[model samples]
Target: MVWKPDWVASKDILRRMGWSVVETTMMNSNPPEIEVPLGNFVKMNILFWNCRGALNVDFKRRIFEMVINHHPSIMVITETRVGGDRAARIIEDLPFDGSIVTETIGYAGSLWLLWKTDDVDVMLLSSFEQEIHATVKVHNSDPIWLISTIYARPRLSERRILWDSLKAVAQLHNLPWLMLGDFNEVLSSEDKFGGNQVSLNRTLQFKECSDVCNMLDLGFTGSKYTWTNRRPIFDLILERIDRYFANPSWRILFPEAAMTHLPRTCSNHCPILVELLGSTPPGPNKPFCFHTMWLLHPGFPNIVQEAWTEDGDLQGAILEFVSKAKHWNYNVFGNLFAKKKRVLARINGAQKSLASRPSEFLLTLEKQLIEEYFFNFTPGRGILGTEVKIECSYVWRP
Candidate 1:
């Protein structure tokens, strides 16, 4: 096998620090070193994950890191395996304003629906054998959506009860609804790989269940196979049993919303991040800036030359140049500067806040923000007089 000393020592430390065999698999490889654009989004972040279990100390730490990175407004975790007794121990530790957890079934499964109360108003609607149903009023606005985080019963015989109960619940509620979880069944043959052929009847049953509930597949980004048996080579079995489905009505509410499968490390199932674009609230206005494309437009230099000659004093000429630039920029090309200034302003504000009153919470948030800003920095190439590290580098989309 591999005998890298650095890797061995790292694994040894994690094992000593209470990490399980599976959780350390994260250190074995980094996420594919390629950039994929998941269009920018904010507000109403929902992360659905089947953590297998959150009992291990190292896994719990990883969960905290995921929360801070995604900044999800609502998070639903399934197969948590946290019993009623242990629920009290973990609920308060989660970085959310409120949470609802269904009673665990001996050792098989559990469900937790956590939300940032500041971002949404969540009310419990029903709690069945394997699901926790709730209504979330995002931003406390109209047209609330029903959300259910379910842990499907493992056996074929018990799945009907789970399906029927959910269908009955859906029939009772007319609101737009979204359901996502590990149903323990695949949608079709294409959803499974290297697993003794998934039976046709099984796929039909799942499709019928979803059809009865009027649920349709929402598209996603990232690895298609979401759940794996974690076995090596020939013994491994993979499936797309974990997914998100929503009715047409829900689509109408958040048309621009998208789901992306984030990098998976500590869990067998990848975490799905939902960007509810329709729910994103407004932010402060962007400042003005010059666009390089303006140079290509006809008569651009003439306008600048006229403005510069009209001024009597050197200071007046400089002021004239800026004012004329703003007018032309706004009327023609639009402002292009957005990244660096925003990053610097946030870094400054976070520092001042920490200085005024130091706290662990502020410190952690600031650290993550700083890391993200530097990670996004694009080194400028053209234009000799530009700042050493400019953020307004133009990228050709085509």
Candidate 2:
């Protein structure tokens, strides 16, 4: 006997699965400024999926479950395979505050971009048949980046147009940019496990386009293949077609950013997650080491001189200098290492919240923390970690 679950039973099943339905709250047009406390990181989660069909009951259930469990700030669904009033009905049932649906061409292709305005501000920049471009600004954060959610055509010749169009978009802006969804093309032979080997010419063409656009694939964890034909073993094919790519600037802005492949349930394409600062693993604590950048500060010499004059012997004076220098570093230049640690701790906290339902306020808080880290630690200095050893002490490279 085939059994079906009702609304309450469905909720019970979700609760048993360790997910709870989050209550929706109305947000004010002008909310109060969010205070970003040390060690409190907000979460920024973007989910992408190509759900083959949108009107199916299974699709609706899976999408709802994902939203309640993952709490993504933004979501993009491709290959919806339905449009017009039919698409509107499914979209109305979605949990997001806002949505943009690109009408499909007679059951062929459609794209849906949905977001919650309380935590994020998404401004539509432009839209094409195969792609939708937008500017996403996480609330309480200053960094404004570009997002291109795509679903390229299956035909090789048609895909060429996609590559050119994407390249054109890249040229039009200098903003930190990210692209996600199914490109329907593999980068290399390693990305394909079965079926006819990917053509070398196609790979090179894609590579050339990426090089011109200065976009690099954001590497992923979990299953290597993201799409499957699901045919018999003798005729099965698997490929890593869906992915996330970002420019160097975006990568630097979210240094701890990561991508995860979710299990394929309601679709042939595995859902993908882009996390700005994923969970951080704890590590051994390091002893306090003096930074050479302190020397660059105008007040460093005065602090050392003042501390040295009040001391008795050479040993006493050296100890006094260390203490005074530390005090000065904290009060004046700000203890960057301590700040970094706090930011990382907050990022870990936000990542942990991903398993449960997080409020929109928490999402804004996460973005605020990320912006603080980016501006504080690496402003003007290319990227963060560069150190060398000298007499049992580590110092930043000039």
Which runs of model 2 end up more than 4 angstroms from their true locations? 1-42, 280-398
What do the candidate models score in CA lDDT, each in turn? Answer: 0.66, 0.70
Per candidate, the number of residue pairs that clash is 0, 2
Candidate 2's TM-score reads 0.60
lDDT of 1 by residue, 113-191 (tens): 8888898888876676688777777774555567878789899888878887777655443456888887999988777
lDDT digits (tens) for residues 1-398 of candidate 2: 11122334434443443223110110122223322122223468899999998876567656765775466899999999987888888888877887877878777999999999998998776677788888787887766678889999899998899899887666544567898989999999888766887899998988888888899899987667788775544565778899899987778677678898875544778789887869555347533456555665677779777766543766566666667866887787666566666775675465334213335554456456666655554425422321112322332122
Q: Candidate 2 lDDT (Cα, whole model)? A: 0.70
| Poorly placed runs, candidate 1 (over 4 Å) | 1-42, 278-398
Which candidate achieves the best lDDT against the true structure? 2
Q: Name the lDDT value of residue 118 in candidate 2.
A: 93
